[model samples]
Target: MVNIFDNKEYLSFFCFIFFSLFFCVFMLFLSSLLGGKSLSRYKHTPFESGIAPVGDTHLHFSVKFYLVAMFFVIFDMEALYLYVWSVSIVETGWTGFIEAFIFILFLLLSLFYLVRIKALNWTHK
Candidate 1:
């Protein structure tokens, strides 16, 4: 029986990893050796568009904004799943089609639930 670790592919993999690490460490060392360390009074201060900021930098956002963002992310992920399933429809055959159909059904049900709960409504209740 041949050892997996003794394979040529494993040798190349190890060499690739070793070189990647060496290159990264060499670049970091070179940068630190040649980089500047100058300090000034303005070094720690925040600069925004070359203008000094005024008033309170921290601002509050509405919870509704967060809710809308969550909804967008959920629907976007569902779209991604459907796209992948579509790409391999032939390989999946009838089983894949039924699974995708159920997935779509669930997606529509969730959307309806969101609507019924008024979660998508923008106006304050």
Candidate 2:
């Protein structure tokens, strides 16, 4: 029986790990030596594209933006599920078809609910 510990493959693997660790530590030390400490007030301040920031950064945003973003995410997820089903449709046959139809129905129902609640209406104040 051949001993695995005496194998060249095992020695090479350990050498690769040791060299990777050594290189990473050397690079980190070199970068720290070259980089200077940040002392300027402007460097610490929140930069808004060189424009002086007005009012609070945590001010309330439009609800319409959030609503639109949520709608986009829901629809995007539906598309992804449909794409996955499409690739395996031949293998799953009728069952896959029914499942995809049900998924789309639920998506449509959610859209209807959003419309009824005036969530889709951006014009309303």
Give the best candidate by TM-score.
Answer: 1
In model 1, where do residues sit more than 4 Å from their true spots? 1-30
lDDT values of the candidates? 0.94, 0.91
Clashes of each: 0, 0
Winner by lDDT: 1
Q: Cα lDDT for residue 20, model 1?
A: 100
- lDDT per residue for candidate 2 within 5-122, as digits (tens), equals 8999999999999999999999999999998888877787787787888887796889889979989998999989999999999998999999999999999999999999989897
Question: What lDDT is reached at residue 48 by model 2?
Answer: 73
Question: Between which residue pairs do clashes occur in model 2?
Answer: none
* TM-score, cand. 2 vs. native: 0.62
Residue 12, candidate 2: Cα error in Å is 18
lDDT of 1 by residue, 34-61 (tens): 9999789999888999999798888899
- Which residue runs does candidate 2 get wrong by more than 4 Å? 1-35, 46-60
